[model samples]
Target: MALLMPASLLMVSATTSADAADAPQNTTNARQAKAKGKAKLVAMPQIVQQGKKPASAGSAKAALTATIKPAKAGRPVALQVQKGKKWKTVSKTKLTKKGLAEFGAPISKGGKALTYRVTAAPYKGAKAVTSKPTTTERWLTASFSDDFTGSTLSPSWSNRGIYYEPDSLRECSKGDPSAVSVSGGTVKLSVIKDPTRANERCVAKKDGKSTGSFDYRLNGHIGTEGSVSMRYGFAAARIKTHKLRGQHGGFWMRPTTAGGGDPRAEIDVVEYFGDKHPQGGLTSFIYSTKNNKAVKTGSWIKSPTSFLKNKKDGWSKNYHVFSVEWTPKMYVFRIDGKETYRTKVGVSDQFQFPILSLLSSDYEISQMPGGDKKLPQTMNVDWVRLWQA
Candidate 1:
């Protein structure tokens, strides 16, 4: 880890300007990485002290709630709010018990933005073990874009049969290329999980329609190798996920190989497994070098505690902007301009020049029961873009 120095460390007093003879080496690294198009991970100044909790005075209130499915029968949920750097308990309520599965209250704190954390528990004796809890935290940023007109994302991204699922079958014409067209000014990719006649398929679809246990391959995956590799830049996508039910979808980049498999590298900007389990999450990972080891980092933003709780968040219905800024030293993953995870490892070796790819894959969620029903799922993407520094 690089030592983060305070910006105040460079203060020059009225007596004399700080001389170069006393400049610190850590400061030099920060300046160099910035010059090379890398973002510096500077630590925020620590809070000197948190004054006593402010009494609930003003009249602004907000509500946060968690719930279970099947109409009106399930466990309760809790929510936490972070004011500045401190976390304060906000609300707790029974999702099914009160007929009001959601909790709401006035947030007296106004003017500034508010961040929240939501949590849910499984039903009684449901066999769903609670793991780490999922966290949904967001702060406002001015650079967020809800548009997708000129991105590199398309149903026919690659030459051979679009490297992804189409947005609609009408566009695909019973799974043909002619029917697949970008509509509504957004790039949408959709897929079917039934037994297919195509040689290669989007095996990640969890539709439970496979004829037999046939060896299935993916329809689309991105790579910069061969004629598509990018050196260093910011790649992003304005994506809307499909109701995968039991699939994984997101943006990733992999190296292309000459023979059978791509042994070069795989960088997953954001991988979401639409499962109701703690293991399912939005993750970022890198498989580099000859070893194929996954050096990864991701945040369990939702349903981190239990997979069953994950299903209620509605990942498929929302449009999230997934992005990756790959520089020479670090890879930063962001969703809707909110920084979720950042990794700095083997910086020089793996990301020397990473190619960009957006992909979707599927497999068993676990070796436990009820896992088989979650296969044949699909992941949707709207559009993807690349920004060079």
Candidate 2:
């Protein structure tokens, strides 16, 4: 067991940046299984946090993550849960460089908790091994993700303008719940013409700056305002945009609306202007309007011709994982695992909830081709995941 201490240490510490650095070294065994040995299970925690509370009996996307000793880097691992009378393999994934395995399956959403364990296949001379059973924690876990599987948005979200706040963070638009829908396993936020409000009205200062009179646009937007906010985490979304230029789609975070919180900054994860324009139509921006004028950084991801899985795909035609790895010191914006931008100058240190919006700010209205003919453009989000530190 003495040989297992280091691996146990990693499980105890949950592989943070400080210790993850040593993970690679632990896997470089000279014998690579040529050395004779029985597969021995190392001591590890027996519980995994899925959400703040145990999932209801029918919940899906609840994940259980595990790590194994002998570091099975890049090797397939079987995740099983004890069923009726025997263990059943529910999912599988390769161990990461740090010997981590993460997989999730629908749990007893509202029933009693479920137990899960991981099994590693034999390699070299080492025999197969399984971790001790770990039970799912009841509702009240941390970290959350939504795969947009159900037909409706999770209760965690607020349709924003419907009851509390008004449309678009900038107020350049209004939100119409009808514009938001979930279909084909993705949440769609479409910028459809609000014919009811098209000639309705516009107040002074559509912030007062564009060529067109503020013709109203209804958008699809949702926020986590009163539900959840975290000071730092990796928040990401996989999305595909529409092919029109009039409205732009975005993923961003806003501070909780509680009175008397810091208004220091807003984290803009990713924003895509409709199809084809300069700078590849993708922008990662950070903004602060605390003292009246705006202070911002980040820009369009340049030369993105090869950023896609292939040249035939574009931001609007394909799904891209856009995320921000937010740490206390910096915010790293990435697209499809490629770094698009990074900056420490305006990273928000306070809790901020996430936002998904498709807006046609009066300021950028002229950029849309064929005008209203392109109405009903959408932003499809497959899922949103958050991992807090």
Candidate 3:
């Protein structure tokens, strides 16, 4: 099971300081949380999206989360709302390990609409960030999890395939609709010889393949881009892979803008090439541009097996839970809900989406032990789940 290690390493540290000016500071509408200062807010009143649930009784499913920019470690924040030009505090909580906060119904259901915002008072060396007013009943529609239960792909997913640029990002692979399929309560991603474009020329060139080389392969890739993009949340997937060479399977994320810059960059949650890889088969990474140079972190998690349930339950043989906690200042990666790697290098500050793929590159073709004989290897995902930070 496995994935992305760029050709060259960026010379930046993962725990470097990040500035508020580095992220998108725009506030959106009534459907989502509106921030006036430096914090990102989202409120979910139910486990699943509903018109509005009774707030008076209190709910275990109801939740409120905030992501603050220029994060202050362990800072206390007041969640408030304006009433007759007066912003009254509803409740207070301190930030988590990554400058994030989550609380249940700050104001118990009162049968009245309350517009809420988070207030982070100025602290030692940390400037204040005040959020805009957004109502409890009118919060962003919380996204539900996809368990891959049906025989077809869910509408939440879009086929993002046919990798044209033969750069390090895509290698020499293309996305074919047929390459991705859902069955038996699981999603399957495969890499197979392209029967349709067997002799068709490729569009881009890697060192090993040029435009004149015939199109020979297709990969399975599906992502949530236009249809639905999640902001900060915990994304987890239970996956099992094959120990094949020449390709890798991965789960990653990116903002809707698709640009390579600070706070709106790529998040490689997990990538596994195969079993017993030189770098130990699993890696987590982040990518963005800082100081006109790329900023990257997260690597082959040094103790991947420490989180495994047992020796027989390795990645290629069984499904394991891989998750990432996205707070304001950094990302914390984990397997089976236990921590693995944490970094502040490139954290996306806005709406981003999830992706799944099994890709190959012409540069790695020589590593396949069975060559084309092992053409249709696959990655099986038991389910995909998400919850706000």
Candidate 4:
């Protein structure tokens, strides 16, 4: 219409046009502000359980995990512990690419129950958020513990496979007391050339067929067979593995009574095949009887390098605690208090005892050509502790 509007009407019409022109920008700004505020609302950090319920105090360590809203990665998260009436920040870590943060809850001595929480710090345009408090189960004293401060292996331990000789699996290796020793507050387990068979060369075999030749070796194999056994508990060892590829270092458990109508099970808490090996060489598995036939569960730990402290920290380079939390429902495997794997299959309810060994098997000796030159590959155990459930 060509007719001009009144002054007052013109002003109103102009204001309407201006408001319409600003609507999209204003709405966008509101959305941005709302999103920034919402980003502060992080999900409560959850305790990663070693069993059906939240991890108890008896575990080597507790893991707390949480996610940030709006997928903010690389943000800092702090773990806090409640003491008396105050909360103390104990540890801090940055979030991963997927907006995840996992904190290893610091445990105190004497097995006392503790409360914990996590907090995300204010960053960029987002505000801070704190998780709700969670209390851990009562810390239980270890039922069995060995610091290896003595000059001899504890009476609680007995040599394993001492009389065993070259077998199909271990073509040229056997257990010998000489391969295990206690001193310097640690137990040293070694794969060494058998003294009596130092000059002997053993033919390595695979599937009962000769594959190659290697020197005779003795392993540090010991167990708490009749001395210590538990139905369900947490078993842990502070150990540093051997650095070579020819041998295996194991912290495992087997039923105290085997080969009857009992539930037969083998819990391999942790196994290492030395450094730089393909497939990472770290595994946690269970072998159990199903329908009167053997069934295996678990596998090589995935992304094993993620368990290490740094690029220079190999499994053999530094001492780490390898542990298993055995419950009637499942088995949770951990390295240095960080869970590596868990499974519900092949859970053992029978009384099982712990075993430690550094062994050479024929099937793997071939991978370490001329490996005998690196004889006496030793694994060190700082201590072993068990908390029975």
Candidate 5:
């Protein structure tokens, strides 16, 4: 499993203090009486920064603080700072009514970054009034976990389907495509077109030659079905495609059916095939089903549609982090933590519930331009993960 680790080692404490203007007082009964009626009111505290660091590259903090007067009597007015995107509680029971309130939690630094706002209400009010968001600090990287970076096959992967044949899309062949291999540190699978190979399987040659006459399309695809099934979490992969040849590569999820009879749903976290479209560049779809392949519904997929170029460089010889977040009712696409695509569903289609597997395709190469001429094309998967809610 590939995991991310904090590159730096530094711990900073969160604290707050009262902001007051201390002026010399007049020593007179009449003056004191007038002063008693006019006491200084403190402004609500604002978060100078979201965290001690930045959430992701190009990410910034959304900060807010409420200015309020000191509460009368002993009834304390407690303040709290909570997260909006993740909905995680950050700081609570703060007594400061002015100056700054620190919420050092990690937030999206760029592309509609997460924010903090001051919420004020009477201690006895039914609801509090929140202030508008004020951007402040930068989001920094957190610790990493080993989600996908290993060789040992776990029970999470079934390896049950017919081995995919290299260069072909046919099924039930002598060389089935399902027999994908991961030895040393690399994961390998065949993308074949012929369905008659053994176990429907085929292999790519290191010398850039076809191993079989079937032209089968066989490649390895693994998931976290039995190992992990998180309700709400994040999954990402850092990958680079084989040069020149165009192939489909992505990180996606599908719901597991109950007793293998429930409706299935698929969330195409991110699918990149070189086909260019007028709206953008890539084409993708978000699909759902009532029963496993029983009734399939789909929506036009978007995001990562535009490509990033460095002067004249293209999408090759580079590694990008393709990530997505699955909530209870929605899914979000992110490139290095910046959100690009966000979709919501009113009803739980029950389609996108399973832990997703990392997948690559060299199949149907004949359908692609110069696919037959291209002797060798490969997709490399860096990692896969599920963040538990």
Candidate 6:
């Protein structure tokens, strides 16, 4: 202390003191810069709009998602719709852990077009941000619709696979008029024991080899093959699927032409394989030909229960709207207006018609414990509608 220190050590001590004196100011400047920075909001490129019938009041909604830069979790985001010249908030939600906000808004009104945007209020240190406005396309009245109000199948639908010709996939089942009935504003599609072959058994074969023998069953299969078809648009049906794993309940579409070559794609909007199936058995897929070879897209839906109304609800317990939006670029599948899956592969450009069926294939018959005792599994269809682009 009293003695003089070395010149080099003295210089080092002075420098250390200076740095300590300036540290607080440096941190203050950095904090000010961050507090002045503005957050950025980006919205999805396309907003899908759905058409709803008079009976489906709240089902006609669209999904909108946006991301906030710098990732501020729990930040508030508002979805706004353009009302006249000003924007009105329609939905409000908090940002997810990934700084993303999603909103489902009841914005579709018959054939009218609507515009929407997202806004994030100023947060702890970031400035307010707004997303670019997105205008939805006009959704006109559905070109094809059946409410199933009549006591019989409409002229629009025809029975399918009435004859029992064995196929590699469905070796034990065939369609019959008795398996389809219309009443009470709904069409009942059932998989029942074939009365004509009540005492006979059907052998399921693959590649000319018999795999197993099953009870002869008749399926409920019907389609609008000749009466209604669309090139690209939205198709939807409200259905309560069959309750057992032995049969497959499907809301699907196929090209009007018979051949299964290029440009002929099969679009399965939704398929359910019963409640107890280990895989949840909910699927959406497409089959198409590419380079003269078969190609398939999509798979079983993950977290299928997330689409249900509650823990007590199931595909067979309540009716859910299954829909597919087809465009030139891709197909988007949805359950109850919420997207389940999407794919750009195997996009069909040909006119496609909708088909509804509850099929009992020989391969799946073993899944049902009681065999023919669980024979008559019925799927109910409340209605079907199509909006052409």
TM-scores of the models, in the order given: 0.43, 0.60, 0.60, 0.77, 0.48, 0.77
Of candidate 3, the 10-residue stretch with the lowest lDDT total is: 5-14
**lDDT tens digits, residue span 1-389, model 6:** 21232221111100001124333457765554444322333222122322222244224455456666545888888989988899999889888677767666654556465777777777775557776676554342467878888689989999998877655367688899999999877899999988788788888665566766778889999999988998776788888788888889999998887554455489999999988889898999999988878899999999898777677788887777788878788898877666689999999878889999998876677777677788799998888888676
**Model 6 spans with C-alpha error above 4 angstroms:** 1-75, 82-88, 94-104, 107-115, 122-127, 132-137, 205-212, 258-264
Q: Whole-model lDDT for model 2 versus the true structure?
A: 0.64
lDDT, candidate 1, 6-33, per-residue tens? 2322211111122355444797644433
Q: Top lDDT: which candidate number?
A: 6
**What tens digits encode model 4's per-residue C-alpha lDDT throughout 1-389?**
21222121111100001223333457765454555322111111112222211122344455445555444677787878888899999888886776656666644446565667667777665557666666544223567888787799878999888754554387588889999998877889998888797777999887778877788888999999989987675688777788888889999998877544345589999999988888998999899987888899989999999977777777777777788877678787877656688899988768888999998888888777467788878998877777666
Model 3: per-residue lDDT, tens digit, 1-389?
A: 00221111111111222344554445533212222336766654332211111111122233456777556678888877677789888779787667766554533345554556777776654557776555555323234567787789998888876655455545557788888888876789998878876766444344644533334678888898877666665666667775786678898887786454355388888998777677778889898877777778778888777767676667877666677767667787866545578987777776678898888766655566676678887888766656554
Worst 10 residues of 5 by lDDT: 38-47
C-alpha-based local distance difference test score of model 5: 0.39
**Worst ten-residue run, lDDT, model 1?**
38-47
Against the true structure, candidate 3 reaches a TM-score of 0.60
lDDT of each: 0.39, 0.64, 0.65, 0.71, 0.39, 0.74
lDDT of 5 at 161: 34
Give model 5's TM-score versus the native structure. 0.48
What's the residue-level lDDT of 171 in candidate 6? 66
Question: RMSDs, each prediction?
Answer: 17.2, 10.0, 14.7, 14.9, 14.9, 14.8
Ordered list by lDDT, greatest first = 6, 4, 3, 2, 1, 5
Cα displacement (Å) at residue 196, model 2: 1.9
